[model samples]
Target: MSQTSHFTKVNRRDLLSAGAALIGAAATGLAFEPKASAEKPSTGATHTEPSATAPNYAPPIVQIQGGQLRGYRDGKTTVFLGIPYATAERFELPKPVPPWQGIKSAQSWGPVCPIPPMAHVGIDEFVFPHRYWVEDEHCQILNIWTQSTSASAKKPVMVWLHGGGFTNGSAMEAYAYDGKNLSEFGDVVVVSLNHRLNILGTLDLSAYGPEYAQSRYTGTADILAALQWVQANIAQFGGDPGSVTLFGQSGGGSKAARMLHTPSAKGLFHKVVTQSGGGEVLADQDPAALLKIQQQIAAQTLANLNLTGSDISKLKTIPYLDLITAGQAALRSVAQANNQRAGWNVIADDNYILRQFCDWSSDIPQMSGSVFSEMSSNYVKSIDKNSWTPQQVNEHLTAEFGDKKDAIAAAFKTSFPRKQVQDVLFFARPNTRALAAKAQAGHASVYNYLFVYEYPVNGGTTSFHTAEIAFVFHNLTEPQVRVATGDASEGYALQDKVSRAWINFAYTGNPSQPGLDWKPFSDADPQTMVFDTVSECRNIHAKELIALLPPPPAPRF
Candidate 1:
């Protein structure tokens, strides 16, 4: 199978164009991940959060390397929030926290790492609800939910990296990110954390000095540090560090997949699952070329601040908006100048975190996929496709597929008998299947999936980006039920199957369950587990339909 072309070496204009599509993809769900940084956290005094969910006043104390800490209890799960894993100075790699003399509070969610906000994708809260937190530059923290705190319980640990590219997003950015339900439902430990991102995290200043050599990679370094902390201390929290699974969506997923190639990341995580975002990270690009792009952005940011690289130290005290705004302008200028799609992605320049490709062997079990209609739902959000008359559907299909509309419709119907004719207009990106193919080709055993579960919302446009997250987390329910997925009963049933498969995959490196016999994807036997109302495995065949349809329009990055 030929690899899907995403960020191929194109003219500078084409590069920026690609960024628009990718950023749109991320916005829809995968890349729908960024926002600008808020004003820098008050620096004179220690930052404090407004009253939120604080740790319980008593009980649930668990001691680790940092100090003794207390978390609250919720239902069957023992929940811990805002636990610091490491700390760092601006634009530097993280450092170990010194042990405190007294028990620290792990009750309230910690401050989120500040990020320069990106363009919004006009997502309705009804589809993907978001949660914002107080922002701080010193946000190196984590949250945990588990059934037990005993070291001997040894449950599988699922550490989530947030989306928002390396630009914006926090551990607590979304409502579905709450790990309590997934933790309790799967009988596994769930951990999510905040880290450095965007300009602060990925700006390359190594061109000027060694102190900032790893600055561009620090966003990832924060994650790597968190994993190291988990391996070292999770045993005390009833998690088997040896069984850690690093999974994420969009930017988070892309970053998690990128970790596979980092020399320091081995053994820290045993399994990997990336949904709808890893394809951008695995593109084979010249690291040196990326380095030049990053340097240009950083230099531009510096000039925007009216300071040269020699005064880079002043960046530590710059306001979040000043820094972010400068950086954002730098990105746009560089994007236009180079006409090259530039990213805040780490320029694989060091041994700490390598620029990623197929950095896996058969030893690491993996799963990677995209939503069935990753961008289709986002594109057609304003139109009510399901209710469209046959003529209307044909008109739309004709407008999109031109003379090839009939062939495409026939192929789509033949390929998806259960699907409505309009579904041919909302096809999954070839990149999703391409991502799975890359994983299979790069590793020994890789489980693949295509999330086809039509969300019962907006007349079954449920297969949009980020739709499956509610299911994977077992979170689609109640009052807001119809907003996310209609037919609560069917949604509930599918959640059980989807969430359990994730839990099983992390628990034993196999996603197969009693009825859904998931087989590893391979060249000789390519198969993908289609997750929907009736989850089942099928051969890879979306290619025919994708081939016949017009190329998908570039999504707004």
Candidate 2:
């Protein structure tokens, strides 16, 4: 079946014109309404409304394993915010949240996990506004959005994990992370959550004692706890525990990939969609190598605290922030000696955490892809859009790609005949190729896509990292998304198309929609769905280009 049958062919001229108009609209801060035909799906099951017994003004209430909780209504969706899923101490495994008293209010977002502030600012701050809430150790919370509060509704659930490596990021960091629109539009339950990060989550202290055996994977444990909560309580929120789908972008994507190998996470989620971050196999470390690093960190921190002992129990008594400072210092010292970045992260402990690589052989279906230009354009200096010339583009590409500059540029132009010179310089396919190869190796169905829709922000930025998020969430109307995507009618149309593909994948493990017949990826025929103004499937799009470039480094945890 031809995927192009449902899409109207979009020529280069139309795309450029629309992009220019989009940039103009963004400059003037204007909004555009989606066409009536593109507003909502006509064939999918309709989302259920609030129960007749629920009163307006008063929030809807639901009973869970712990106690009764109140949640608010935002238009057609019911939102339950900041529900505690688990609790844990510093460097310890997560435990289920204790039951609370009657009628607890889940009105506001919970505290975000502690991390360093964003020092290097970029357009990302505007695109994904950082939400500043209370920060503490007791921040293992989850949020839910559903169209129906009835236990019998049985809608498919999408659990979102935020991206920031293993260090920093919150469930509510990005406006695109909002679940209301996605819940209402897809008639499915949407979930997002917060868990421990950095040293608090992944400090390897197993050599100290068996109590800390799983401490290196506390963040993942927290996620497992959250899924367990969903399995036990999500029925009341209109979600199907049996049909949960795990989806995430960037670091979150890596986590989702890792979860596939986790023994405890086996039946928790049946499907996975990893966006731009889950392609590589996590390298295993020698037990002694990790122990050496941890021991170095411990020595420095202990001396800084004016204490002397191998006993790690004393660390629990130090002030949280103070311990973090000491840990950072120790990490830097060890990293300098090892000549690598200093930070705590997941390790293949070989006992409690055994999944060293994503098991594509499992029955869990997978869909993974990267943006067209992942972080390639972020290095470009701030210059007037009109001032950018072909010479400048060539110079930048030559500097970045060296001898392969000409070949890379030619391949990009051949692939995208209508793209601007600046856009061509930022064309990247290594990550996409890597992910496709990994997915193809898996036994279960694997679908791949290249998000080719460029958002005309500050004149134009190709499909950069994180740009496909708003579209997946069906949140093109948000101000930040508007700034990046412009008020183009085509943008909204694409949102409906892409978001529906995701919703469809969650529903049936197939991303095929009304007009698009997405095919599974394989080594012999590397079919990849290119999502643009007019989406289509293209086979082996990056084969030649990837061959010319150096192979990417192995996937790291």
* Number of clashing pairs per prediction, in order: 25, 0
lDDT of each: 0.79, 0.78
Candidate 1 C-alpha lDDT tens digits along 1-557: 00112235457578798789887887777744444587565678686666555544456899999889988888788988999999888888999999998889788899887766656754656677777877787788999999988899999999988877777788888777889889988999999999888877788888889888778888888898899899999988899998999899888888887787688887899888988777754345577787888889989999999998779889877777788889889888998888767667765564565544435444778888788787667335566677889899889988987999888888887766677887777776546543554555565468778888776666556487777777887777533533656656777898899899899999998999998899887645658888877778887467777777767555432
- The residue pairs in collision within model 2 are none
The TM-score, computed over Cα atoms with residue i paired to residue i, of candidate 1 is: 0.86
lDDT of 2 by residue, 1-557 (tens): 11132468688588998888888788889865445875675677698877866654567999998999999988898999999998877778878778988898787898788875455765656544555666877788999999999999999999999888888888998888889899999999999999988778877666677887777788889999999999999999999999999999988998887787677787789899999887655443475676677667667767777766565678876766777777777788788787765566665555555535345336788888878877765425444433557787778777767998888777766666556545655566645443454454566788888888866566655677787888999998877667757778989999998999999999999999977999988666777888888898767457776666555555432
Looking at candidate 1, the ten consecutive residues that score lowest on lDDT are: 1-10
How large is the C-alpha RMSD of every model relative to the true structure? 13.6, 14.5
Error of 1 at 531 (Å): 1.2
Instruction: Give the TM-scores of the predictions, in the order they appear.
Output: 0.86, 0.83
Instruction: Give the lDDT of residue 111 in candidate 2.
Output: 77
